[model samples]
Target chain A: MKTFGGPVLFLDRDDINTDEIIPARYLTEITKEDLKPYILEDLKLPGFDPKGETTKAARVIVTRANFGCGSSREHAPWVFEVNGITAVIAESFARIFRQNMFNCGMTAIELKKDVIDALFSYQDCPDTCITLDLVGQTLTVQGGGREESFAFEIAPFDKALVLAGGWVDYADKKY
Target chain B: MGKTTAEKIFASHLVDEPFPGAKVLRLDVVMCHEITTPIAIADLVARGKDRVFDPTKIKAVIDHVTPSKDSKTATQAKILRDWARRQGVRDFFDVGANGVCHALFPEKGFIRPGYTIIMGDSHTCTHGAFGAFAAGVGTTDLEVGILKGVCAFREPKTIRINLNGTLPRGVYAKDVILYVIGQLGVNGATDRVLEFRGPVVDAMSMESRMTLTNMAIEAGGTSGICMPDQVTVDYLWPFIKDQFASKEAAVAEFRSWWSDDDASYDKVYDFDLSELEPLVTFGYKPDQVKTVTEMAGTPVDQVYLGSCTNGRLEDLRVAASMLKGRTLAPTVRGILSPATPKVFQDALKEGLIDVFMEAGFCVTNPTCGACLGMSTGVLAEGEVCAATTNRNFQGRMGKGGMVHLLSPASSIAAAIEGKIADPRKYLPE
Candidate 1:
C-alpha cells in the first residue's frame, strides 16, 4: 500500500453530503480529470473551478467520523481521486464511500481522534509528514515521532481490489 | 451462540461473512432515487449492462424535480422520464402517481417481509416498516445493485427502541420519530437497525409505524423495523401472492424477527409519548429540533409540506383540517405536494384541495421536486423553512435555501403562524 506523504488538512464537520462534494448538475464525466475542479464546492472556497478544474495533484484528506456521510454519490471519491487526494483518514466513513474508494483504488485510513487533531494542528506547517504502513496497520506523524496504529481491517476480497489498483483491475485478474 | 432472524438472513447471504462481531456483511437488494440514479445509470451504461437485474425489483420514481417550473428543468425531467422508461424500470411511479417512493412502495406492496431492499435515496429504509432489510445506498451501489441484484453490508448491532406506554390522544406517530432523532442525534444510531417494540409501538397504525422507521437513515442507520404483528399481516396480505398470501403466515413470518423476552441490543432508547409535544426540526439538520411549543418565536421564510417522509394522504388530511377554517400566515410559502396523483385525486375528492387553495397553499403535482432543489419553490437568501421531507442539508431545497425538518402537522402549524408554531395550537388539542 502507498504511504500517503505530506501533512494532512483536517475538516471537522458532520453530515458532509455528496451534493456538497460535487453538485448533481455535473454528473456526466468524460474522465476522472473532469471532476477535480469541484471537490468541496460547498466549502465556499475561492477559485471554485468555474470550468471543472479537476484536482491536478495529490492531497490527503483528514476528516471526522462518518466522513463522506451522505448520499452514495460516487462523485465524493471521483472528485477526491481526480483532485490528487491520495488517501483519506477519518474516524469512520460512510459505508458507500469507504467501499467505493477501495474499488476506485483510493486508500482510506481510519484514524483515532488524536491523530486527526494532530494532523489538523500541523496544517500551518505544510512540510509536516505522516507515514502509513499497510502491512503494519500503523500511521505516524514524522514530527515529534508521534504515531498511532489503527487496524484497518480490509477483507481479502477488498484488499485484492485495492492491491490490484481498483475493482476493474481485480475483476480483470479474476475473470 | 444465537442469532436474530436478521442475523440468519445475513449469514445465509454472506459471500463470506467478516470475522465475528463485525458489522459488515453482504447485501441482497438495493434501491435508488432520481438524485442518485442519473449517475448510477451512467455508470451502468459505461459498463454495458443493458438490462437491470430485475426491472420489477427496481422502483424508480420522479418525486424529485417533476412538475418543473421552468422550461429548462422541464426538459431535464423529460429526459429523466424517458431514461427511466428506457431502463425498463417497471415501477416508475411518476410525479402524480409517485408518492414519496418509500411511502408509495410499501403502500403498494413492493416491500415484503424478510427480503432485502435498497434505494439510492437515503430514506430507502422506509421499506423496513414491513420487516424488510431496507437501507439507502449511494449511486455506485445502485449501479452495482441494478446489475448484480446485491450489495455488501456489515450486520449492525441492533437497537431495540422499546416504547413503554400508549400514546395519548392527538399524539401522532411522527412524534415518536422526532423524539428518537432528538435523543439519538443524526449519527447516534449509525450502522444499527432499530427495532421498535413496546406498548406504544403496538398502538401505532402501519402508516404511522412506517413514518417512524422511514427516517431511520436520518440517523445513519442500516434500517429501522417494527416487529410485524396482526397489523402487519392485514396491511400486507392483500399485496402478497396467494401462494404467500395468508395473513397468519405473514404474521408468523414477522413474529420470528421479534426479539425473545431476553433479547439484547447494543443500546436501548425509550420515549414517553405522553410527554412528546408535536416536534419540528428548527434548522437544517433533523437532529436540530425542538417541540412545537418551542416554535412560538422562531422565524421562517417558507413552509414545505410534502416529501416521501410526510407526503401521504393522512399527512395532508391533518394539514388541511388545521387550515380548514383559517387563512395562512402572510409571506410564508406553503407548498402542498401529494405523494402521487392518486393521493392528489383523493384530496380533491375529499375537498382537501379546496381547503388548501382557500388557505393560500399552492398545491403541486406529485413529484419529489423542490426538496431536492430540482425545480419549483427555490428560495433566496438566508431563509429558514420548515418541511416534512427528510434531510435539511444546505442547498437541499435550492441555492442558499435552509430547510428545517418537521412532520406534516408541524409544517402546517408553522405555515399558519408564518413562523414555527405548535400544531396543537392550531389543531384541536
Candidate 2:
C-alpha cells in the first residue's frame, strides 16, 4: 500500500540516529518483514515494532535538527517503510539521512521554526489542528479553531523525487 | 591550465571536454554501503533490471556492518551477500577480508591507475591512492552509474602540494593530512583536486599514499591523487603480475599520467616536511587538529588505531613498536583493524599483532567497522575516543560518542596514557 495517509507520530527527541529507527542489524535481510520488528528498540521506544505494529498508521514523523544524524545506513527509512512512515517532517536532516529517506519512498520535508512549533503545539495542545499543505508550501495550524499558516521550502531535486512517488518510480522513468 | 587527475579524467570523459572551468561531470566508480545499497537495489529491482550495468566496474564491501553486531547488521549483510553473488561483482571482499573499502579497494586492485572510480560512500575518494580519478556519489546517482556504464565528468582545478624535506621522526602520513586539513580549513579544497608531489611522496609506500589521499575528502576537495612513480609500480606489481604480465609495461602505464615537469598547476602549496609533528585531532572536525605534545593530559576513553588510512602493515608495525612491553591504560579501549588480509598477515608474521594483543590492543578482523558506525567497537555515551579513521562527524562511531581523530602514532600514545599525548615518549630514540 502507498502510505500517503498517516496518523502523524510526534517523536519528541534530539538527534535520533537511523540505527535507533531501524537497527542496522536488520539491513542484511532481503525482506522488509524481517526488519519490521525491533524498530526504535535501541532508542528506548520499545513499543514501536519495526517488522509489524499505529506506528504503521503514522506516515509522518516530525523531529529536531541534525535529525537522522549518524552512519549512511539506509535502514532508517527502511524501518520507516516497514513501519509505514511515508514522509518525514523535520527542521533539518543529515545529508545522508535525507537521501535514504527519499530512496525508500519516504517524503522528508523541512519546515521552518513557526511551522515546526505549530506541529509541536498541535501535538502538545491536542486541541490545536494542524495540516501540512506540502504542495502549497504552507502549514496551517488552528488552536481553539483559530488558524495560522507558514510556508516551507523543498529543494527542487527533492521535490522531483518525493513528489514523483520516491526512488522506484523515479528510477523507472529516469534510468 | 594546471591539471588535477580529476580534471584530466573529466576532460577525457566529457562530451564537450571542459578544460579547467566547467560544470559537474559524470562520475566513474559508484560506491555503496549496506546503509544505502538496499534502497539502490530496490530501485534497480523495481525497474526489472537483472544485473548491474557492469559488475566489473562496481566495488561493494561490508565494512559498515562488520561483526554483524546485532540482527539488524546481519540482515544488512545478508542482502549485500545475495546481491553481490547475484550481480557477479568483480570485487566484493567479505567484511573481515578487508578493514575499510577506501583502503582495501586499492589494495585488492579494484582501483587501477588512469581509471575513474565512483562509490556510493562519501569516502570513495580514498581509492585515489593508485592515481585513479575517483569521487563520491549519491545512491540515486550511483543507480545511474549501474544503469549506464559511465558517469558524467568535468575536470577539477589542480592544487599541487610540494613536500621538500624529509619527514620528522615521529610524523607519519596521517599527520601530513591533518596538517593539510588544518592549513586549508574544512572547505578549503571545495571542488578542487589535490596532487601530492615530492621526493617524500615518491619514497612513500603505496599504503602510505592511500593514507594521504584517504583524508582528502575531509578537506572538502573533489578528490586527491598521487602521481604514480616507481613506488606505486613496485607495490601493485605483485597483485596485477598476471594481468600486466611485465613490470616494464606496468611502470610505463603508471608513468603516463604523471604531471609534466612544466605541467601547469592551478595552485602551488609548499610544506616544510621536517617541521610537521605527530598531529591529533581533538574534535569531530578533521581540521580540529593539534600536535600530540600540545594535547597531553587530555584523557580519552577509547583509542582506535586503524581505518582505510594507516591500517596497513607499516602503520601496524609502528603501533606495535609503541605497545611492546607496555600495557594500555585501564580506562582506555585500544582497537586495531588491519587494512587488508595481506596487511593482517604481514603484521602477524612480523609479530605486530601478538605484541598489540599482548599489550591490550583490541584487534578485530579487517573491516571498516566502528570507523563508520556499523561495528562492535562502538563508543558509549559521552565517551571520548582517539581514532585513526577518517571522518569524525558527530556521533560517527556511536550515539553521543565524541571522536578525536589522530594519526596511528598519536593513537598509540593516547592508548598508553588513556589521554592524547606525544608519541615521542613511547618512540625509539
Candidate 3:
C-alpha cells in the first residue's frame, strides 16, 4: 500500500473546472513536465495567485465540491502530478477527473460537506499539513496546535490501482 | 429484476466482473481526436506496447485545432496521423474531411443502438443519443481501450428524466437541456446515466437528440441515452440499410436495448416543456441558467453559433430564419461555424450561408477552435459572448472572457440586439 500527505492548499470554491486546473492552450506540450508551471494558471479564486508562494509550497489541495468539473482532460491530473501534489481532498469530484487521479497513481479523497467545512478553518495556518493512511483508510489534519482525523473509503479495485502505482502498472501486471 | 437501459447494455457487453460492483466490458468503438489521442499514443509507444486491438474499431479525427495553429499542435496532429497509418486504421478524417469529432463520427453512422463506445473527449457522451452506452475517459482508460479492446467501470445506476408536454414555441433542445441542467445542478447526475424518455424526447430529431446528449457531461452524467425508435432507424437508414432486412427490422433490433417498464431507477424526475422559454446560462457553470426574459438587455460583445452541441444544419436553419435580412448590432461580432463539411455544404445549398454573411456574420471552417479558445474567434479580456456551445466555463472561449450558453435561435437574437434577448419575438406567429 501507499500513503500521501503534505502542506495543504485550500481553494474555497465549488466546481473548479479542468480549464482552471490547466488551460487548454498548453495541452499541446509534449511532456508532463511541460505542464508544471501552468498549474491553476487560469483559476479566478479571490486570493489565490498562480505564482504565489503558497502555490509553489503546497503538496495537497483541499477544495469545496466538484473540483475538476469540466472536460475529460487527463492533463489536469498530470499537472498536479508534475507539481508533486499527490492528493486532492474535496467534498466531491467530477467523476472522470476522480478516475484520472487514481489512474495517475494519485489520490482523490472525498469527505462529507461538513467535514470539508471544518477543514477550511485551518487554511490560514502557515503550518497546516495533512497525511493519508491508505492501509487504515484514515486522514489526519494538523495545524495551529490542533489536529483531527477522519476516515475515508476507496473502491477495492481503485485501491488496488493506487497500490500498483496507477493504471499503467496495474495493466502491466494483469494484461 | 428489470434492468435499466444502461444496465442492459452493460450486461450484454460484460467481459469480466472484476469486483462486486465493477465490470470490465468489451468496447464496440474507441473514438480519438488529435488533442487527447496523441498523449495516449506517446504513452503506449514509450511502454513498447504500440499496437491496436482492432484497426477497424478505431475512428480517429483531427478536429480540435485543425490546420494546426502552431508547430506544437502540428506535431500533435503528426503523431496521431503517423500512429493511425502504422496501425492501418482506415477511418481517419484529416483537416478538409474533418469536422468536430462528436459531430463527424455520428454523421458517418458509426454509432448504433446497444453499442459500447469510449473516447478521450468529454463530449463522447453525445453518441448516447442512439441508445448506445457511451462515456468519456482519460488517457489511461483510452490507452487500455485502444490496446485491449476493453475498459472497466463501476456499475452505473439510472436517473430517468421524463421530459413530457409539448415544447413551447421558440424553445429548442438546447434550451430544454439547459433547463434540465439548471434543475439538476452541475453534479446532479454524477456517476449516473440519464435516460431521457417521454413525449418530448420522442418528438426530437436525431440532431436535437444529439444536442441533448452532448451536454450530459455538464451535468456530471456518465451518458445520456434515448430509446431507439423509427426516428433513429430513418436517420441511420442511408448507412445501415445493408445490415438489416428492413427499416422495421432495424427498429426491432434496437428496441431490445430499451429499459423495461418495470425497471428500477435510482431516481426519477419529470419535466413539463409546455411553459419552457428560451434559456441561457448566466454564470460560468452550465447549471447557472436563466430564462432569456430574466437576462434581457445584458450586453454581449460577441455571438458564436457552433459546436458539437448546436452547429447542426437544423441549428443553422433556425439561426438563418432570424438573420434573413437583419444585420448584427454595430458593436457585436458574429461567427458561424457549421459542425461538419457536410453541414457546411448543405447550408450553402439551402442559401443559409448567404443569409448569415449578408447579415454580417463571419463563417469559418468546422473546428472546435473558438469553443475552447484554441483559435478562430477568441474573446478579448473582459469581453462577453452569447454562444451555442455545451460549456460556459470561465475563460472557456478566452482568458478573462465570459460566455452565456444558449440555443442557436437565442444566440442570433443576441447578435441582432447586442444583448441577451428572447428568440420567441423573431419566430413567425
Model 3 lDDT per residue over B1-429, tens place: 898889999999998876788788899999999988888898899999999999999999999898899899999999999999999999999989999988999999999999999999899889999999999999889998999998888877999999999998899999999999999999998999989999999999999999999998899999999999999999999999999999999999999999999999999999999999899999989999999999999999999999999999999999999889899999899999999999999999999999999999999999999999888899988999999998888898999999999999999999999999989898755
Comparing 2 and 3 on TM-score, the stronger one = 3
* DockQ by candidate, in order: 0.33, 0.13, 0.79
Model 2 Cα displacement at B227 (Å)? Answer: 1.2
Model 1 DockQ vs. reference: 0.33
**Mind giving the per-residue lDDT tens digits that candidate 2 earns over B177-249?**
8898899766566556778888778778887888888777676665788987677778787688887868888
TM-score of each: 0.88, 0.75, 0.98
- Which ranges in model 3 have alpha carbons more than 4 Å from their true place? A1-3
Taking the tens digit of each residue's C-alpha lDDT, what string does model 1 give over A1-175? 4335455545666566666777654543434567776677665434333234222333666667777766656777878766667678887776666777776766766767776766666544435456666556666664444454444555555555566676544433332
**Compared with the true structure, what per-residue lDDT tens digits does model 3 show for residues A1-175?**
3447889899999999999999888888878899999999999888889888888888899999989888999999999888878899999999999999988888998989989988999988989999898889999999999999999988888887888888777766676
Q: What TM-score does model 2 achieve against the real structure?
A: 0.75
Candidate 3 residue-wise lDDT at B158: 92
Lowest lDDT sum, 10 consecutive residues, model 3 chain B, at: B15-24
lDDT of 3 at A84: 78
Give the least accurate 10-residue stretch of model 1 chain A, judged by summed lDDT: A49-58
Clash tally for model 1: 29
